[model samples]
Target: MLFARRADWKATKPDNLHEPVTSTKGVKVHYTGTRFEPFLEVHALCAMRVKEIQREHMEGKGDSEIDYNLLVCRHGVVFEGRGWREQNAANGNRELNRAHHAVCAPTGSGGYTDVPEKMVRGIQDAIAYLRRHGAGWEIAGHRDGYATQCPGDLLYGHVLNGSLDPGVLWDGGNHIVRGGETLGRISVRYNVPSDYIILANPDDLDASGKVKDGMKLWIPARGVPLKGADPTPGDDATEFQPFPGAKWFHEEPSSPIITAMGERLVAEGCSEYAKGPGPQWSEADRASYAKWQRKLGYAGAKADGWPGETSWEQLRVPYVGQKPGDFEEFPGDAWFHDQPKSRIITAMGKRLVEEGCGHYSKGPGPQWTEADRHSYAVWQRKLGFNGSKADGWPGEYSWDRLQVPEDDD
Candidate 1:
């Protein structure tokens, strides 16, 4: 592999260097996030770019040195930055920097979607070198913990799919499952059969034939797709996933369901994820869910980030199961709180009155009123909801049950 020392690139010696990072969870893959020039393929230009990056990090970003431990060029040449000796600043914040070593590639968005094979090889080389030093086994993209799209989509996909891993050979070795992966998903990942994996590690799975995060399973060599057919995500990637039960959310380990939920939260403009809404549950998920709850008129402890049945139903994540019927999407609790004059509200009031839940003394006009809450509360009680769940707020489940006429308003 072609390699260059800092001296080779004439990089200015940085005045500040942090204590050496002797250990880390793994390496984070990054991209230049700038337009790439064809001329950069030349080693000299690559060197110049490396210098430019150092200058930018040191002068522009006020970093003590180049943020990456190493950088890979288009031609698969690895250039030393901090060179695995010092901590990197490119992983977003202090905690993230402490956890993962950073390696950047000279690639970016817009006309730079496809990554070169050689570039990938160089990144793998950097990762391998880091591992031999003190890095752990996980390989992740910068976006895994950071909010920005540094590595971009194509490369980030490679990181998640293990294309960036130095090893792809499945030798029936012991495999450790991480958050967001199951036996079925792992089997598809390694081209191994589900039954074969189950047969090999009989003690690792639970009664339901599922693997938990951090569980170790021995995978037999690649076998015919489960039952001599191709494998698909099945319910794993559905339009509307059934709530995996409250326990799954409250206590289950990292899961793709959580990731799906995070994505939904983001879609609903209620994201609080700083790093990832990845498969693992974190404060970000709770904070984001709290936003969703508050949007739905929940307050105080009611707006807590935990996913309740009503809130989860309202989020309507596209995961494993679908909600039946074509009721109008919940316009959000905030909308009703705004007391907007609209035909939608009028129609909803009519439905509440028809259901014998209306407490209105006057017309259930376009304008919202306290009577709407009283009526909705009655409906919620009729549905067996009490306490906070019975609050007059129009939850998605109750709203759907009411089947208020669809209105342009």
Candidate 2:
């Protein structure tokens, strides 16, 4: 939480070129985007880099000062940019700039994609500093409302999961219930255990365990190191079934995975199936999942029955030998028909054989052929697809459902 003044970086005096902004919605995190060299961890080098960025902003974009409100270096030092006195120009457009204060990390692709713990703490400190200076409670990545991936994948993951939040004290506190806020949502926001919160606030809950608006509830802090109970214990490393894309559901795919997911939904009291929660995707599965989303406080387009990453993670569907993020992304429809020869095809062919749909009499070779097509058609049929939908060419949805291992795997 060390602060360096604009004078510390030898920054130019305020030109009043940037507009005045006393308050903002929250803070948006950004990264260097380009490669950030490792040698720049030195304090002098970090200051030099900040000065370089300021010069780039002044000369290239014709800005009055650095576009960011604050800049955090890898060594956990917070450098003053535009600071709290002025609106930042880094959040894409004028409207966005007015809404959020921008905070840049000196981490990016190539050179420093994985941020260190100290750097994470530095960014957390930056957010805390912003909140103290009239910024609101929201915290988002730069790519949230914009087009480009300014914060990159690693940091954006932290932003989504609340890892970058300057968490409240874990000792204990009274929290006034906000409108539309549930115990589940509150636990996520505070990084506390829901069970612990419920145990602490028995007086505030209704007969069915729902909290009313404006109810004052006790929030027990995590990491108390008590003898008998640990509020947040280490999670067992269990494998989770990766979400086979939404298209897989509409195609009526039949697999053990489907039955597992249905069983989980049933356990959660969200089952809508009239008969068997069987090894097949049906309209019932969609309806049941919609109920699950509703229970989670989602509505409108968000509760459309299709699985999103956030909802899927919350489902905690037991793994069938694959982790959530380990699956390969779709390589595009053109990759299959381009006469390509690669191990990815071989892996896919092997999976098809394993699924008992291999139509080839010879080898499941790396190249695409009629046998491969016929074999894939069998797979499509196995998944309950038909006619034009079972055309044998790999669609992104079916490909994802197939869970074809990457060449590296």
User: What are the lDDT figures for the candidates, one per model?
Assistant: 0.72, 0.73
Candidate 1, 355: how far from true, in Å?
99
* Model 1 lDDT tens row, 142-209: 88867988798888888978877765434457788897687789877875546556646656764366
Largest TM-score belongs to which candidate? 2
After the best TM-score superposition of candidate 2, give how far the Cα of residue 300 lies from its true spot, in angstroms. Answer: 74
In order of appearance, the predictions have TM-scores of: 0.41, 0.42
- Residue 279 of candidate 2: its Cα lDDT? 71
Write down the RMSD of all candidates, one decimal each: 21.7, 23.9
Model 1: number of backbone collisions: 7
Best by lDDT: 2
Per-residue error for 33 in candidate 2, Å, reads: 0.7
Q: What is candidate 2's lDDT per residue for 61-107, written digit by digit as tens?
A: 78778889999887666788998778988999999999999999978
